[model samples]
Target: MAVGSFFGSFDWSAFLNALILGVSIASIWLIAALGLTIIYGTAGVINMAHGEFIMLGAYSSYMLQNYVGLPFFLCVPAAFVIVALVGLILERGLIRYLYKRPLDTLLATFGVSLVLMQGVRLIFGSDPKYLAVPPIFTSNFQLGFVNISAFRVIVLGITIALVVALWALFYRTRFGVQVRAVMQDKEMAASFGINSDRVYMLTFAIGAGLAGIAGSLFGVLNIVLPTMGTGYVVQAFLVVVVGGGTLAGSVIAGGATGELQSVFAYFTNDTFARFMLYVLIVVFLRIRPQGLFAPSAKRR
Candidate 1:
């Protein structure tokens, strides 16, 4: 197990290749985790329907590309908007009613997710949809023996851009100030004449919207199934929890989570790696009881 003996002649080239793959996975996790971090940080609501929102995005993108015959570039933002709208509608309807009863909020959002996913199933059947990368994007280069796909590179680049844009919006805007206000102390924010209800609604919508965009991008980069969002939702929460309860915490958690999952998947069975990852999360939560970097003031 000594460092020098662990690899008599380690290959730096292979190490770089693995690093590239790790970056790809990490970028995706950042998007998925953004949804949870925003909603949980701003509104203190654990929206279970978050995944279904992603499902909505993926399907929206599918419809735009295939059914509407729109171009691929157009489908990207349209998918984001469509998902954001779904989140908005859900907030105005079901989410508002269950806010006071948090435990019920979970059930309500879970119901929304079930309903949304099942609705897709009924309308589209259980078939998976596909998105074709544009010709210029489809062509990729080989680095020595490794073949890197164009779509994977696109996913990583877009995810990085999204993270930067979100970070700016959250930390730089008045909207962000109001959101942080409510997050820090809802009752106090309301007392100071801030519109708590409206903020909550918008915050939730953004969270759902983020998930939707992530799902759509995921579909483009991978497979599009009705249950596709389910895998991501679980991953998102794990990232959020592992990182901590704050927005920044989620990012930190997501990167770590994605890296571990990637490394494990390479050397171990995917199923076992996934299980142990969750087990590790549970153990960490038990030890800290407030995520790795959760705000002490928000601790219940």
Candidate 2:
């Protein structure tokens, strides 16, 4: 009787909705973590200012949309260019000097984060800013048993495109070969005439540019603010760490974590779901500290 009663109360429709929604959640985390993965995996820099880079992306979009009268579509790429430039400048000016000094790089980037936050606060004040989107994005549509926002679908599309592009960049080009060589053994890559320094500069810029794209999308999901990146950064870090700082790892971790969280929330509540998710991550890490994919022996 008890088993029957439990079965009778099950809401298959809601569960299905949550399951589909998990994909959207996964995309959000994955997109945000993409840049962090590239930076940490390739450059070995614990970029504490990555969140600030994200914030800069959001503000860049906001500025271009409002002041320059660019549409949201144009703002996305523009944000990438602007933030990538900032990243290049940062690497050239400061981060390049701190290579192999993990603690110093972390502390320095943390200082950079503070500077960026305060600088933005001074320029834009504390009030939240909003990004405008098209009416289509504001609408909801049904997909099988689930109803989802159009914007989420768009985000998912963007995430897929990014992953595909990154895969090509990592596996299909001469630059990709150089990046992997550098990632595996900087000295070896340098021996072959691949400039390790140039690779690092370009990779860092690309990573920061990815964060910028994430920011533009995320700004539509929530109001833009100097501190908006804080919340997203936590989840982004989780994806990167759990995935072992590899591109493929981030993708798998993002999807698995997002789905697990969604299912947990479906069974319980949001807060408890998050608590349970964190507990699971802790346990998972305790057993496999290297994450989903361990680095090659050369990288180690």
Candidate 3:
């Protein structure tokens, strides 16, 4: 009891530290989860390769910055465009064929992920690619007792802004309505003359674009690696399951879950923290098996 009490003291520094770490990791999960949710929820295709798209996006930033010597700010959008195009090509060439069959789609994407990782390794030689952030982002600022990296703060701002913009895109725009329509009932919505194909393409592009955005910022946070996407895939899957496959819920839940894991890991060891994360997923699924935020099902 004494030891437990000692560990549980109301120390402001520990509390703030936990909060910062939580917010940081949770935001990462949020980004990864957003891309996964968009593709999975809208198309009902579980894209196992979604993380590789993010990996590619990060690589895109590195190539543009280190290879072409583009300004850091410019590399960001280039990453987005490159990954978005990849998503488009994958959707048009592969995913479009596997639409009605869900499991096959998963398997296909899994294969694609393997190929992508290997391709990245073959090209980049499995060495972590270095991406240097601009001086402005590398600087740090203090908020009361908390000192935060400017880069992290910038990433958080971008994540929040993207979330808001996505919500608006889906909730306020005609394209969003069409996407939601297809999600709720693809066949029926298609019968209504909504171009399901276009909707799928656009949604897929958006998901990929979000991934590119995440990777652009994420590359600055870590050395870009071939299998880096492996880390994000499971976390995003869990976020989709926990949050119920909605774009908004995935972002919120992924961030929340990441934050929780980080804080728990801070108090515990890495293995135990991962165990706790899985336990939360099992506990969450037992409560809402259909997912927390899936659109109304139109399955006949």
Best by lDDT: 2
Each prediction's TM-score against the native? 0.91, 0.96, 0.94
Candidate number of the best TM-score: 2
Give me the overall lDDT of model 3: 0.85
Candidate 1's C-alpha runs over 4 A off are 1-12, 143-147, 296-300
> 1 or 3, which is superior by lDDT?
3
Local lDDT at 97 for model 1: 84
Give the clashing residue pairs of candidate 1, or none: none
Looking at candidate 1, the ten consecutive residues that score lowest on lDDT are 6-15
lDDT of each: 0.79, 0.92, 0.85
Off by over 4 Å in 2: 1-6
lDDT of 2 at 14: 90
Model 2 lDDT per residue over 226-300, tens place: 998778777888898899988999999999999998999988898899899989999999999999996694835
* Top-down TM-score ranking: 2, 3, 1
Model 3 segments beyond 4 Å from truth? Answer: 1-10
Number of residue pairs clashing in candidate 2, backbone atoms closer than 3 angstroms, sequence gap of 3 or more or interchain: 0
Residue 298 error, candidate 3, Å? 1.8
Please give the RMSD to the true structure for each candidate, in Å.
Answer: 2.6, 1.6, 1.7
